[model samples]
Target: MKFRILLLFAVAFLLLTTTRLRVHAQSGKSAARPNIIFIFSDDHAYQAIGAYGNKFAKTPNIDRIAKEGALLNNNLVTNSICGPSRATLLTGKYSHTNGYKRNDRTRFDTNQTLFPETLRQSGYQTAWIGKMHLNSLPKGFDYWNILPGQGNYYNPDFISQPNDTTRYKGYVSDIITKFSTDWLDKRDNSKPFFLIVGHKATHREWLPDLQDLGAYDNVNFPLPSTFYDDYKGREAAKQQDMTIEKTMRLKQDLKVDADYDKDWTYNRFDPEQKKVFKAYYDKISKEPAEKKLTGKALTEWKYQRYLKDYLSTANSLDRNIGKLLDYLDKSGLAKNTVVIYASDQGFYMGEHGWFDKRFIYEESLKTPFVIRYPGVIKPGSKVDDLVLNIDWAPTVLNIAGVKIPSDIQGKSFFPLLNGTKATAKVPWRKEAYYHYYEFPEPHHVFPHFGIRTDRYKLAYFYNGADSWELYDLKTDPTEIANIYGSKGSEAITADLKVKLKQLMNQYQDKEALQILAGAKK
Candidate 1:
């Protein structure tokens, strides 16, 4: 009886050891799956980032992503507006295909297959922790904490799952970072994770943190070369209502006073928030009065204030980004994680004397995109291929080793990170298509669509005006001259039209087709 008891105990110990070894192997396999963290911000212009050659704006943390990996030089957005651009990133499809064309309060179709949904199904935990701006509860995320539309900078409210909202007491950027790091601490370690840290900083009506007040007081930004463009030869440029001089108001935008005008932005602030804001702006308001500025000088003053406040907000954004990066490094997650720093769309940083975006101009059209994927991508790489916001979804999915759906319009650029070709038979896209549908409200930019090639860009503003504008980007890099009907440009224009029509057909843009039909050849 004693010998039989000893044999039973030995068998039990051997089985327990074998089970432990098997579980350890499975956990190691899970770790092999790359984790993805997409850090998206609002209205973050490429030119403002330190890596993109901006001496005025200080963005060391954002630059770190580019330093560690690749920076996409030609990253363009299909629609250069907020909501539509986010929709494009989620669906890997353009505005027309995704059914979210304009930011005129359109609801996103949640039933559509998002890349997050695919990632979740493939044994990954997904979360979105900040400004989603999609006007609806996010779908396909296992965890979601989002801000309401154009979320406030001070004491923002976060919308969690099942339509629950809780106001968090802090600056929006810091709060977002806190929530993101908290999520990382609690995530299931057995599965790979995909998280989106969306930031509302640097958006319109730019508000800086209390500590960042007067951050750019000592600096003076030079006026853009096209500050007094006069809109000669370009009808669309003349018609736009986004000029900094006329559109950006001193009281409303510059925060001179809470009750200076009927602007609705100040109403969102609480009494305590108002007190703090008043103390800061009122002290700075003396400069404008002392200068006794008017006309051009006044315009320059507004421009300076605009840059100051904008960069101040950006300062907080970069600081929060550093916090997240530090957490990743300390936690040992940075090795297997792919970190992407991008914006919904680029903003106008006093380029062309404008404060808002919507044009297919270079300032608004090209978004800032930098990614750091260890082991897969080499450090300090720069990709100049024409990439669009639509490519974000497929690329992330591809990195996770998940099969991309057939309906996704974007071709995964995962191979590009490694200097390899995409598995697709067709060559990488040489031209990028752009379309902007917002008009007659907000900034009053007209609806337009265009195609940009390696050396030229062709835009057709066809909502109210039937006109065409073309630029040879190589010679006219600033796009000051509209050479559409200029001599010796007939052949180039003709070729571009053919390419435009092909893109429209490929994307199934029926509305653009109807407009193209009525356009002058």
Candidate 2:
């Protein structure tokens, strides 16, 4: 009996020792993985960011990211629309593959796997704060406080876990920043975290914060050179309804309440809110009425008002970013956390006489992407290689030492950051494919798909209107001239079509393939 008792005691001691060792090994592995913070904003054009050379705006906090880390000069989006771009960033796949192609009130199919889910499974705590306009509750996140639909600019309602919404009072940008920091305070420090701070500032119907109402009042923005584009060569450009002159309204967009033309936007505000808004806008409204501005003068006046409000909204966004960066520094998380700033897609700030995004134009196609990885990436580095929104997932997974799924369409560009050779010496993609499907409603941008190389761009506008447009980017950087069927352009056009077809096949875009076939016939 004594011998049996001694043997049982020895076995129990061995089991305890093994368990403790396993726990210690797991803790060490988690500590080695770097934390990730992805900051996303809506309708923020790369041209508006000071880091990207916007002389009209001040973005010191955003510029700091570029100064501290790497800037992706050629970061482009697969789609230029809102929800589709967000879907692509999460799934690392195009809109067709993810089944959220258009923003016509379609719900994001959350059943499919997302990169955040992969991170959560790998023992990382995940949380998403602020706008995630997916029309569905976010999956794979342990904690989420998101906005419903586009969310209000003031006193937005944040939808929390277990499906409950609570209204918070403040500017949307400031409220989002506060929730993000609060989440950080309550998070489990034992495990590494991946947090997404999404902001809804600078979206259409640009409403500046009350404090920022008169921020840019002193500045008068110059008109874009293409503000008077005749649409002489481009058929699709002529048919769209997103023009700054015609589509933008004085009461609805510019907040000029001259006659009150039944504007529903202002009706949404409460009595107190309306009083404050009227006090500020009513004073400015009298000037335009007194000037009796028309034609060039009227357009120029509208441009200044639009720019002032847009820049004021952007000012709040930049200030909030500073707050988050300060928290990281004070909390000692700056050394190990990888901070990333990006947008769902770029917007048009009076480029080509347009006010909305959905075209495959340069202003809307390119987004600002800045990253700061303290130890891994060298400071002030600039990557000129073409990168897409779809690459975000694979890159983040690779950074966390997580194995990227084989089915993800995007290839990780982590090698570009760390200066390491890929295990497989595959060539990087030299061109990017773009497709926009939303049309005939809202902005009325035509459905088109195209390919963009370093020096050229070719597009096919189909969906009732069959046309081809090509640009020699080196000679026509502004894309003012269409050289598709022009003389001496046969070789380049044929080459671009071949490359476009190859990409369509690679991505398995059956709709695009059918369209290409029809266009060829």
Candidate 3:
């Protein structure tokens, strides 16, 4: 009887040990999945970053991502508009297919398969915290605290799940950081996490935080060489209403002679915030009236003010990025976490005498994209491949070990990050396709579609401005001269047109195809 009792005890111990080992192995497997944090900013120009060769701009925190991992030089956008760009990101499709081509009154089709839902199904906790301009409630996120449509820079309101909105008191950048970290702290530890820290900084009417008001006051920016563009060949350029001279308002945009009590932008500021803001701007407001500036002098002054305000507003954005990086390090999540920094679309920083985005031109087309995926991507790597905003969703899904749906138009550049021989060496697309649909409203940039190769750009503008513009990018890097129908450019123009049509057909852009068909007739 004693021997039998001892045998039973031994068997019970063996069973318990096996169960513990199985559970431990499962936990290890779960922990191996990398956590993803996408730090998305609004209208952040690539030229305004330190990593992208901006000597004057102080973007150390964003530069850190480039230093640690990869910086994509030619990361272009599919449709260079605010809402449409974001919709393309969520769906991994172009603007037309995603059904959110323009920034006006269209709602994002939440019923469609968003990449976040795929991540969640694969056991990752997904969330989006900050500005999401898609005029609808977030559907796939487990938790989302989004700004209500072009959120204010000071004391903004965030919309949560079940349509709950709470006012947060602080600079918009700072508030977004706090809420993001708070969510990170409270999330379930067992599952891997994916968070989108959407920022409204560096957008239109650039308003800096109180501490950052006069940050760029000492720095004098030089005018862009093409500041006084003749718009000789490009009819679209001549028709645009986005130039800094004419579009940017002094009292409203630059805050010269601003009404503290009446202006909606300033009314949200609390007493202490208001006092600091008023003290700074009131002193600067007297410049225009005192100088009685006019002609080129007035235009140049506006350019200086625009750069100062825009860069100042970006200060808080970079600082908050540092905060998030610090948090990841402190929490021991740094090793397995992937941090990505990018913008909705690139903005114009006195490039071509413009202030806003929405063109297939270099400044507005190519945005900043940096990623830090430790242990996988080699440090200080630079990818000059033609990756688009549509690729973002598939890349994120790939990082989470989730299967990308067949409907997603983007191919994952994950292989590019890892530098794997098998997939990385696969032939990538040589030419990038671009289309802009928004017409004659905010910027009045005419609707256009085109293809950009390494050495050339060919575009066809329509809707009352029927014209074809081609630039030999190798010679005209600044795109000063359009060589369309030029003596030597017939073959290249014909080639680009054929390739553009092929891309449109491949992407299943029916509307664009119809438009192209009509243009040909």
Give the per-residue lDDT digits (tens) of candidate 1, residues 53-151: 999788999899999999999999999999999998899999998999888677899888799999999999999999999888899999999998888
- Tell me the tens digit of each residue's lDDT in model 3 across 1-521: 99999999999999998887665343222237899999999999999999999988879999999999999999999889889988988999988788998999888899888998889989999999999999998878899999999999999999998899899899999999999999999999999999999999888889999888889889988888889888998888999999888999988899988887998877888999888988898889888778999888999999999999999999999999999999999999999999999999988888788889988889989999999988778899999888999899998887777899999999888767777634336677788989998998998999998899888898888998888889988889778798988898888888888999999999988877888888842
lDDT of 1: 0.88
Candidate number with the higher TM-score (1 or 3): 3
Question: For model 2, how does the per-residue alpha-carbon lDDT over 1-521 read when each residue is reduced to its tens digit?
Answer: 99999999999999998887665343222246899999999999999999899887979999999899899988999899889998887899988899988887888988887999999999999999998888889999999999999898877888998999898876789999999999999999999999999999878788887778888898878788888888878998889998878898887788887333366455445567667877999988887769988887888888888889898989999999999999999999998899999999888888788887888778888999999888677789888888999899999998888999876899888777755534435367899999889878887788999999898999999876578999987988778798889989999899999999999999899999998998942
RMSD for each of the candidates: 5.8, 5.8, 4.9
Candidate 1 clash pair list? none
The lDDT values for all models are 0.88, 0.87, 0.89
In TM-score terms, candidate 1 sits at 0.92
Q: Which stretches of candidate 2 lie over 4 Å from their true place?
A: 1-31, 258-264, 267-274, 421-426
Q: Going through the candidates in order, what is the number of backbone clashes in each? A: 0, 0, 0
- Ten-residue stretch with the least lDDT total in model 3: 22-31
